[model samples]
Target: MKPFKSYVVRTNEENQVTHQVEEVTESFLGEGNTTIAVEYSSINYKDMLGLQTKGGVIRNYPMIPGIDLAGTIISSEDPSLSPGDPVLITGYKLGTEHTGGFSEVARVPSEWVVKLPENLSAKEAMMYGTAGFTAALSIAALEKNGMKVEDQPEILVTGATGGVGSVATQILRKLGYENITATIRKDYQEESAKEFGATKIWNITENESNGRPLNRREYKYVVDTVGGDLTADVLSKVDEYGSVAISGNAGGVKLNTTVLP
Candidate 1:
């Protein structure tokens, strides 16, 4: 086959960032038991930040920046993956430390690749991406921490217009959660969040406060994708002894709050 094109994020020996969308020969691909002809890749947040002007996401030089990919195996020696097998990969440092999923073809370790499930197609799998995965993790955390439909109060999902929030709302609704409160940044997303099962929607910046140490209880379980004051505020609003699953740092890092009795 001819040379394949890839968007490689390179850092020099001094840890300087460089990005290049160029063609590469197939021989340069990492060696693995399974060689896949990549068909689809999703641009998750990690992938976006990793391919920057002065890339801070990449640890090694000349690495491709993609965290998720779905493709068919072109060659494989492993029993779990044979030629023509459809597969998808996420996490496992595929894009961060290793040559990633952005190329036309990829050679991934068989252990890291998952055979596409019966009901899922390659395109469908990529559509969910890492955001959906995080949402699943958040819901799982909520469930493990004793969240139930009988909790009366709704589940609060912050950053609701983003990828994780949207999917979590859908999943919670599908699981029969009666009330899902979505907190988004835009007024337009209020409608979308409602459609995704949010019975109530709030803007991220709409409710201004005087940094109260505690607030009225509103949520039973909270999925916070935006950290900082938002997380602190959610902490105050959660029902007594309730739990929260938090991910993301787009809001802020240091949280300003005091634990209430």
Candidate 2:
């Protein structure tokens, strides 16, 4: 009913970072037209990077780092929305630049909040989170790029065990994409991928050679999560004018390429 606790990440006197669970007061939150009683938040890969000492995601010291949250508005200054409305929010620098939702409450700009769809709940929204949204964006991008389920011979989803990959696989299946191939490094993720509608699964190694640019027209569509060399490899093996919907840089950020004949 009042102010509450929030987990925060900050830098120490030596400029080394630290993370602690601390009580947050009412005044510290950013200016907002709506106040939300935070209900659920999810651990995204970006959040993991921000939380881990090894992850350099948090650029500013003394920051909160949650990328997604779902809750109900307590009050609203905006006429487009009212009090007691449920909302879902991901992206828009929620946890990066402003106070975020790894807390009992969050006061956020009303524009940052998205009303939950009729069939979806606060809990369901968090379950999908930013990763799922990114997946949707990837598929939507593929569609925009002229890759259609009815036309593509096969669609390859790389990083098949990860959050984006999982969601993409499910959505693709729901969209009736039957010729789906999943590429993963772990043998254990096959069953899970199959559950999501991956008919073919393969374990690819970083060491495996992905011979030559523009290999024998394998995939008409690719949803790539791991970038760097893998992205390079996938690009090379694409069918003429095929599309690769790229979304993450988990493996490596740099992408190098040379055009094929």
Candidate 3:
């Protein structure tokens, strides 16, 4: 009932961006059919961008910046949802084109909300957030393409210390995949990668280019979180009939590759 609080990002006339927690009211919330009393929100890499000067994430000024949130619905215009219903939401333009979940309250399109599963707590759901969901989807896509744990071929995960890659590595281990390799940029990350059940840890140099058009087939499956030339290199290294699921572009955005690879 009282004015709520949120972290808002605004670009000033001087072209500097300021981000801080501030008080807000219902009117400040974005257009949506459902209003939720937010219980938890997780910070992703995208959330960090909104705080930067030229992060290129916010499509508008004075925005709340969280990509995923979980909470209990306080009100809803849609018939399928009602007050006190537990829910979680991600994507559908949240934190990009719309006011996001870094607040005490969030108003979002009803279609963007999903009923929280009975086994998952709101806090637990936020722990998964966008990065974890991305990781899950990446694995699901690989499975849909016929990658199975039973076959037991070596699986590769790029950027293995990152949010998506780390979670993906652990999830793969949990699902009975024993031969998992994680690619890291530094030597110190080998232990961390192993904690995620990576059977082997590779440096970026080992998996990336040495200027070959197509290298020897190495991995049967790859969950690539870094896109760019690395992706092109990964493509060339994939075994025949294998598939790759790419989900991030932190390395770069452009890809130059031949179909032969």
Candidate 3 C-alpha lDDT tens digits along 178-212: 99989999889999999989999889865558767
lDDT of 2 by residue, 1-261 (tens): 565888888877777768888888878776788888888988887787887665767776667778889989888788878788898889887777777778777878888889989899899889989999999999999899887767746899988889999999899989989988898787788899899889898678633645576666678898999998888888877887788999988879998877662
Rank the models by TM-score, top first: 3, 2, 1
Per-structure clash totals for the candidates: 0, 1, 0
TM-score-better candidate, 1 vs 3 = 3
Candidate lDDT scores, in order, read: 0.83, 0.83, 0.91
Estimate the TM-score of every prediction. Answer: 0.88, 0.92, 0.97
What lDDT tens digits, residue by residue, belong to model 1 across residues 60-102? 6678878989999998889777789899999887787877888
Residue pairs clashing in model 1 are: none
Using alpha carbons, what is the TM-score of model 3? 0.97
Candidate 2, pairs of clashing residues:
10-62
List candidate 3 segments past 4 Å from native.
Answer: 206-208
Of the two candidates 1 and 3, the one with more favorable lDDT, higher being better, is 3
Quote the lDDT for 72 in model 1: 95
Q: CA lDDT of 71 in candidate 1?
A: 92
Q: Show pairs that collide, candidate 3.
A: none
Tell how far residue 251 is off in model 3, in angstroms. Answer: 1.0
